[model samples]
Target: MQLHELEEFRLHAYENAKLYKKKTKRWHDKHIVSLTFEPGQLVLLFNLRLKLFPRKLQSKWSGLFEVVRMTQHGAMELKNKDKSSTFLVNGQRVKHYLRNDVDRELEALTLNDE
Candidate 1:
């Protein structure tokens, strides 16, 4: 009957949706990068307040905090440059701060006299 065909189509659609979700999740998890930090390394903390005040040119990360300690479960203790204050934040909420620590040699060009 027509009702039996419709039920079969619904069951097929449901199974396809479940398979799609599983494939998408596996792809996402494969691309994730795990971050590890050492003590005394500088890192930037993600600003959660940015979601409240969204701006086109505003930066999403704020502050340079030193890694004071890390817990086995992805929790980290961070301290500011002056060591004035310390706070515990999830490791997922921070990233390695990129600073130009490399020393590059500068080249000098000589001008030719006409």
Candidate 2:
């Protein structure tokens, strides 16, 4: 009788664990924001080597690269303005980079009422 009880208890524990994992996955999926990038957009790549150098007061983000294309697996191919080099990185590692005068040029080109 004791052996049967032990087996039943183990099965109950497994069920609880499975339920906990399912609940955690649902919660995590809710919090994640899906981001999409487009070609020709300027973006900055996160510097993953910051911990290697450990410089004081150094920025954690690096480089302004144009998005040449997005891979089928969601990786982005980026190149600098000079097009000297290009590299592929996961989309999560990059963010859109906005210039200080991004809106200035659009505002400057006003249509005249003729």
Candidate 3:
């Protein structure tokens, strides 16, 4: 009787392992997301330094710019806000900022109407 119980436990463990493997494989086969950029687009540059840059320069998380050139397949060349310098950046380093641009434009238009 004890031997039969041990065999049943082993079988249960084997079935659970097979189910876990199937679930893991399903997760591994899931698709990943992708992003792309084009020239003349504006983007925010990511600064690795937790310390902030001077206000006249790029603030740690606030630097924004235009895409002056596309470098390697997934990289880009970005011109600084003042157009003084250009930087090469990987796709992972950039984030789209169109909403900010529209907000600024609307503010400018409203001010001009005043």
Candidate 4:
């Protein structure tokens, strides 16, 4: 009788764990934003190296790299602006580089007023 009770409890616990895992996965997937890039697009690459001493104001991302090639496995080949250097990086570590269009627009407006 005691063995039957233990087996039932184990089964219940297993089901609860599976449900929890499914729920957690669903929640995580819901929050993840899908990112994609095209060849010739500019992007910034995230630096993963830990510095000996971190500066509070230093920017961690470094790039204005052009996407030279894209792989099916979520990797990208990036080239320097001058085309002198190239490297392959995971897409997860790169983000689209946003230009300061607003500032340029403001400057244009000011010039028109002048």
Q: Pick the candidate with the highest lDDT.
A: 1
After superposition, which runs of candidate 4 have C-alpha atoms over 4 Å from their true positions?
102-114
User: How accurate locally is residue 95 in candidate 3, as Cα lDDT from 0 to 100?
Assistant: 81
- TM, every model: 0.77, 0.77, 0.50, 0.81
lDDT of 3 by residue, 6-93 (tens): 9999999999999999999888868545667777787887777655444566455557788887766778888888868887878777
Write model 1 residue lDDT over 30-102, tens digit each, in one string.
Answer: 9999988999999999888736657889888988899999998999999999767888999999999989989
lDDT of 1 at 108: 100
Residue pairs clashing in model 2 are none
Model 3 per-residue lDDT at 7 = 100
For model 4 the local lDDT of residue 84 reads: 76
Worst 10 residues of 4 by lDDT: 103-112
Q: Pairs clashing in candidate 1?
A: none
| Predicted structure 4: lDDT | 0.91
Clashing pairs in 4: none
Error of 4 at 79 (Å): 0.6
Model 4 lDDT per residue over 31-100, tens place: 9998988888999989899899999999989968999999999999999897678989999999999887
